[model samples]
Target: MIAARKSLDGLSAGLMLILCACWGMQQVAIKIAAPGVGTILQTGVRSLIAALLVAALMLLRGTAFFGRDATLWPGVAAGLLFALEFLCVAVGLNHTTASHMVVFLYTAPIFTVLGLHWLVPGEHLRLGQWLGILIAFGGIGLAFSAGFEEHGSTSTLIGDGLGILAGVLWAATTILIRRSSLSEAAPTKTLLYQLGVSALVVLPLAAAMGQFGAVSMTPVIWASMVFQSVVVTFASYLAWFWILRRYLASRVSVFSFLTPLFGVGFGVLLLNETVGVRFATGAALVLGGIVLVNVKRSPQPVPV
Candidate 1:
């Protein structure tokens, strides 16, 4: 049993790492498609496609997609938060540098820690964790300062702010998932709620933003949309929720640090963006802080 448990833990860690890598690549994919598609259109198409693919997968796997309990409300709330997060990201990307936007989006973990402390009474960060959060936030500030100096536009600043807002929304969604009765629901049903709510929310917003007409039938655009929907958004999220349901959220969340690192690397490789000392230094600090925040220490028993 010990060996089997160890193996399962190793596999779970591996899966989480892959998920992070894929998420990192997703930033690159979005950047690639951004030039051709409006942000709203990109988000809407990706959500729509992902929802369809997830529906299909559920059908194939014989898993019931809808939750049968009061948890449904929390699931719906999570989905709304997911939609809001993406909407902010999409609109914000239009106004900001991709590098800056990526960095700002990582602030989600900070928000997560804060939210968890407030909503989940038993979970609290130690002083060391608080220090780590500060260090990580400082790193984010440094990255923002450097990126803003190099590529700052007014629109970019707006987008960067939006990205931060998106992170807050994401954190809220996570906290809701943990604190609400939805914690006991099936992962698939929970995920389906998130996607469905996001799709519903984004469709009208995208349409109102005049992104509908911007949609093209081009093979490249379609391919990017489909990949974002099926691979990154749908499959990746399914795997993520599955892990979250089975594992500790804090430990799993630490892997998110890799997303921005991968985003920076991909930006350099694919978009030909410059990778400088500032970016590297900031990234190291951010990743280090993430590690510090995530490391678990044994809690002391209360005095009898």
Candidate 2:
């Protein structure tokens, strides 16, 4: 692998935006198909399909998977976390607007930063970083502070809780992957583990919920599933891994702040969800704080 680049070139920046767009559209796509396919079951089945696609891509690219014995345990653990993250997403989308869910889910970086400060050497944050994290969480509180008396409030609150939980799990999964022997494994293999294990793990739960029979072969469901399995799950991830290999993490992370914005935009446009000033304020802070937390500061001038 190449040493991480210290800056983002034009092409990389463009690619980052494209990938963010892909991620942003994912929730909207799933919500569109949720009527025909039970969200939870659809997620599992979609993941199963993605696993096969990823495996085939790995072979086509001459990439080996699970080649090292040391990677297995951590891989499985990360895979389970990945499954649980999306499970929350699937469940939460049923009760809340997709816009709300995306805002909360992107809080993963804050949680991950806080966890890594003490857990990993060289991962300590400056005061500015801590300030950014607090600002982000403050936005979260503001968004949910006083809406319980409103209609559908109970479901919205529950959805918010699940979305936050999903973010936490996403953070935990990142920590597991970065801290594990899988850090040295191929990106495809790491992704394969997540998709493969998630495919297996979600099946029994889907069965218990009787979600298998919920799937209908409607055009919307088919389009959504195909998009999820092909573009977002497989192509977007491969592009992400490739971009990460070529760009500085900090720069890439800053660009990722666009994802929730895209998600919110798509949700409002596609689903016709009303956005409140509170949500708008919270999303601004969330996106702003993410940019503040991830941006690489300029180096000081050389001494005389």
Candidate 3:
């Protein structure tokens, strides 16, 4: 009963660019607020705030959460993975620059493609996609080698590894959704499951890690929380789901590669983080690979 989805248009493209910018800025926001609030606490609190907003939205939409659908197990699994992903993000950022963290995290698409190729029928990779995978890993190696050059700092390397692990977890979540009843559930429902479960998981984890007492909650930190909870987590996700419903997902996915670029830019502008020439070159390859991995080949017309 769904309408046929269309290719990306002008408005959607612009909105996607805006969305990418918001997503890119997310790491920088976390970094900015980290001085006042520990990263785990920040992530947990924001998830809690956004979960409330999403619940309110569901209430207004009259969407029932406890349906007869078989999404519960998959949803819980996805939520656990989501918690782990952000846990990596929160811990990893303590050791790496926001720019580096963003680049590494956005590698999720490559991992997702690889995972789908293995798990899902009819999702095999083409030559271009294979090339993309190789290029992206090559870039990862190049960037990771930078940590070796630092001689005394293994923390950055550890952070980068966590970032890649987060990407893998994110891909796993996507595959789980695609392979389960959550694929048919309302997008809001899926999102709420992730957010609600993440809040429950991370809050306790943060407390166990002794991350709660660090909260200083300055005006800037509060603003960062608002931006993260309201704008980035709540509004941006809803916009992304709306876009997916309306546009060709493959084409729409291609633009997501821009997120790291925007993230790097925001890190430079706001956080004053430096991007070395070596890292810049590697990030370029990673972005290029991600684009190739997501872009589908257009079919040729047969000659009469």
Candidate 4:
């Protein structure tokens, strides 16, 4: 049994790492796809595809897509928040560079930590945690400042602002999931709710923006969409929710610091974006802060 548990632990860690990589690559994929498709259309199609993938997975796993005990309103709310998050992110990408957007989006964790503290008592951060958050936020400021200096434009500022809003929405969604009764819902079902909701919200907006006509039936676009929908959104999200269910939220949330790191690296490689000193310095501080916030201390035993 002990050996089995050890193997399971190792497998979970491996899965988490893969999820992290996929998530990192996902930012790059979306950035690549942005040129061919309008942001809203990209988000709508991705959500629709992800919803379908999750549905297929549920079928294969013999799991129901709808939960018996889950409240419809909570699911709907979660889905709405998810949609807003994606919408903001997609639109922000159009205005800002991927490197800038990625760093700003990571501010979600900071929001999550704050929201959890208020919504879920006993989840509050200590002084050390607050210091860590400040450090991480400073990193975010640094990244933004670097981007602004590199591309001094009104549109870039707008994009950066949108990116920050997206982070807030992302954090709100996380809090909703953590605090809502929907926490008991099956992972597949919850994912479907989020994806389906986003698709519903964005599809009409994309149509209104005349993005449907902009979509080309190219192999590259199709490939990017498939990766975003099936692999990153569906698979990684399912795994993320599963991890949230099984572990402490703080513990799992801390690993998200890797997203920006991966995002910057991919931006350099795929988008040929130059990494500046400010970006490096800020990312280091942010990641260091996240580590400081999440470090676990050994428990002291009580005297019998």
RMSD of each: 4.2, 4.5, 4.4, 4.6
Give the least accurate 10-residue stretch of model 2, judged by summed lDDT: 295-304
Decoy 1 TM-score against native:
0.87
1-304 per-residue lDDT for model 1 (tens digits): 0100011256776897788777777766776677678777777777877777777777988977654578777877898899989888888877776677777787787778777666654456678878877777777676557567866777777888898999889888877887676666766667778888888888888788777777555677677677788888888988888776665555556557667777777778877877677766877888788777766555322111
Please provide, for model 3 over 1-304, each residue's C-alpha lDDT reduced to its tens digit, 9 standing for 90 to 100: 3334455667987898899999999999999999899999998998999999999999999999888898888989988999999999999999877766776787787777667667754456678877877786667556545544653268887887888888788778877876677756888888899999999999998899888977788899899999999999899987876775555443455457678778877877987756577767877886777666656454322111
Give per-residue CA lDDT, model 2, range 97-116, as digits (tens).
77667767877766776676
Q: Sort by TM-score, best first: what order?
A: 4, 1, 3, 2
Please rank every candidate by lDDT, starting with the best.
3, 4, 2, 1
Instruction: Show the colliding residue pairs in model 3.
Output: none
Worst 10 residues of 1 by lDDT: 1-10
TM-score attained by model 2: 0.83
TM-scores, each model vs. reference: 0.87, 0.83, 0.84, 0.88
Clashes of each: 3, 0, 0, 0
Question: CA lDDT of 218 in candidate 2?
Answer: 84
Best by lDDT: 3
Best candidate, TM-score-wise? 4
